[model samples]
Target: MQTAGDETVITVYIGLGSNLAEPAMQVRRACEALGQLPESRLLACSSLYSSPPMGPPDQPDYINAVAALETTLSPHDLLAELQAIEQAQGRVRERRWGARTLDLDLLLYGDRQIDDQQLTVPHVGLPERAFVLYPLQEIAPTLVIPGQGPLADLVTRCPENGLQRYE
Candidate 1:
């Protein structure tokens, strides 16, 4: 974490996923878009992973990765930007856990915990989701998840049935 004048810059972790419209390309493009976010810089990104669909199994598999970022934007504002990116990418919210062109989830925002209707930090499913845990563990294994514990520990308890490191 750093400060720009009075504004605080927080190191945030983001999860990116796509299952449609050239999944890998969509993810790479989203990574580029993340770097372009206001007052944010992409620090490091984990290698992509291929994971089975979480919500429904019938859909296509997803391309997933986690990113570390430094940002001055408040959590809500950053969430808004992410939603905008999804909207721009032709994302349709017609079904829950449906296939998507692009999906950006704010996995961790510093060490702060937020649980509002609009956003949830340490993403509600971070601990149990293999897709998220895999890439996050890859990029920042020693990282702690505030209300939870070390990411390394979290990664251990989670099953790795559907996660494959995308080469």
Candidate 2:
């Protein structure tokens, strides 16, 4: 963790997804919102990506992206902030991977490995999901996923599975 004056700052990464209410726009707006969070600065955001749904196949395609941040917010606090953003975008927890206006995941928190009920840093699925890995690789090519290996290696092993850069 780096010190921002007296406050401690941690490098964090966020995964973004949407398949409802103009998905692309939702992701773009969400990306902008990440920059507005308190005690945080949006360092970089990957290009928007289009990917097949991970859950029910009947839903519309999803617009996805990854965002990197330098923040002083604690892990739980950051998770709460992400949930708030999702709630504001009309997110409802109806089913796992159900359609939603927005889904913001706290992918990483400064190499910290957390497995609490509320949050999991280096997200549980980060290593396998192409939607998450590809975009993450774009923004942080040199990143090492705490318990997992290098981002580049993971990207090489994961199949595209219809994931593509959004035009």
Candidate 3:
């Protein structure tokens, strides 16, 4: 965390995904909403990407992106705000990795490794998800996941998995 006067600010990375309700628009709008988050400023957002679903093959393809934010909110507090954004965008918890209107994941919280029941920084699947890694590389190519080594190395090891940059 960086000290700005008395407040502590952390750079966070959020993974955004949606396969329902015009996904690309959902992701773009969510990025806008992130910029509006209290005690946070959106630093960078990657271009949208299209990828095959990671869960049920029967579901539609997903639109994904990564966003960088510098926030004074604590990890859990930042996570709560992210969940609120997902809910406001019509996200539902029907099933694990099910298709959704919006999915916002707290991928990283500064350089911290958090393993609480409510959230996990450097997201549990961050190392293997191409959709997450690719967009993340676009925005923060030099980032080193708190526990997962360097971003570029991870990207090199993770296949495209049918993920493509959205035109």
Candidate 4:
């Protein structure tokens, strides 16, 4: 909701993950690529975490992390940019929650609420996914989950069965 004249920047959070090949390397490359986007600055990046596959458990484990960015792009535009980054990293959407070289999800876009075919603000599953919540908490511990109360509180309620920090 920032205007052009406002000196303050709009802050957004993105969740990144990969499990296809050299997962850690892919995550690192994604972090670097994100910072190169136009009018975007990567403010913080959570430590990489290893987590079991969410769907079709037979797939390889994923390396996940969350990133904070200050950007002037609109939510939709930011999402488009993220999609482009994924594509550049050789992402393929051939299967739902399937293994891939890069997975970039827009976790939150300046506390905005958006529901569209291509994107959902505050990400629909932010409250439930530890992979998203844990890294988010690392950078923005006091951030409220919009409808879900304090993020720390939500994290406590989340099961830790499949999530673990890398270091």
Candidate 5:
């Protein structure tokens, strides 16, 4: 885990998705867990959504949402926290985009961009993921996606496709 010297709170956006083992419950529980991190506080979470699987078509659709958080932990530490929560939720890395009990991604870390072996901020595939874009729009309509564009524009370009509010 890494920490910055300042220890000031930074706002971050997280994307959560799951397609197996009671996904809705998994997501909600994950949100609850976010508020318990060592130096983090959950600020907001988008409504749950149902979207077609981003990978194999045979699997179940995914339940997804985005969360906003204010944290004093560095980006790496925050990533570690998210992975721990997923592990606690029984996440297994069997196959890429395969069904899972939980999928927690560090979508954006205080307007910063990162690309490395372990993770990528603003998600490398953010531009094309309706599941992410929709929920993000709900919580942060005018937020920008760094190199991509404003969240509002991306949401409009994102097709409704197989997504629907999970209500």
Candidate 6:
């Protein structure tokens, strides 16, 4: 439960994805839930992108997007809220990169670095995932990836093929 000193608001970027049961609708619902948080406001949202699955190759394609938020909640608290939303959407952690109703990942937290068993800020794998980087670049092109360079550069280097921006 890391809190911002003096109750300052922290800006954060979150990545959302889903491949089951009206994914776009689920993502929209999740965004609404974020706005319902007591100390959080949805600041920006990237256009949706459709992409093939990342891990095992036998799943449906996914709809992905990135969102920006200003919040007084700590990183861990935000993560918990996201998990609750996922559970409400019937998400079950059965397999890695498996089909899901909702998948929410915290991409960055105001230039902060966090390394814990349950959560990692500036998400470790975000730089290499087109589903994350492409949409992230739309909303926050100048975003720096902690150890990496600007997000736009990383989006160019990401090898994910068949990523199409949604209409």
Tens-digit per-residue lDDT, 1-167, candidate 1? 77999999999999999999999989988998898999999998899999989888889999999999999999999999999998988888879899999999999999999999999998998999999998998889789999998999988899997799897
Number of residue pairs clashing in candidate 2, backbone atoms closer than 3 angstroms, sequence gap of 3 or more or interchain: 0
RMSD values, in order shown: 0.8, 0.7, 0.8, 1.7, 2.8, 2.5
Report the CA-based lDDT of candidate 1 relative to the real structure.
0.92
- Residues 1-167 of candidate 2 have per-residue lDDT tens digits of 78989999999999999999999999999999999999999999999999999999989999999999999999999999999999988899999999999999999999899998898788999888999999999989999989888899999999999999998
Residue-pair clashes per prediction, in order, are: 0, 0, 0, 0, 0, 0
Instruction: Estimate the TM-score of every prediction.
Output: 0.97, 0.98, 0.98, 0.94, 0.94, 0.93
Q: What is the Cα-based lDDT of residue 133 in candidate 2?
A: 95
Model 5 whole-model lDDT (C-alpha atoms): 0.89
Over the stretch 39-83, how does candidate 3's per-residue lDDT look in tens digits? 999999999999999998889999999999999998988888989
Note the Cα lDDT for every prediction shown.
0.92, 0.94, 0.94, 0.88, 0.89, 0.88
lDDT of 6 by residue, 1-167 (tens): 23567797888998999999998898888877877877888998888899999878898899999999999988899999889989998999999989999999999988788999999888999877988998898888888887777887898889768899876
In candidate 2, list every pair of residues with a backbone clash: none
TM-score of 1: 0.97
Tens-place lDDT digits, model 4, residues 107-167: 8877678888988877888888999998899999999876667999989988876788996
Model 3: lDDT of residue 112? 89
Alpha carbon deviation, residue 142, candidate 5 (Å):
1.6
Q: How far is candidate 2 from the true structure (C-alpha RMSD, Å)?
A: 0.7
Residue pairs whose backbone atoms clash in candidate 3: none
| Candidate 1: clashing pairs of residues | none
- Return whichever of 2 and 6 wins on lDDT: 2
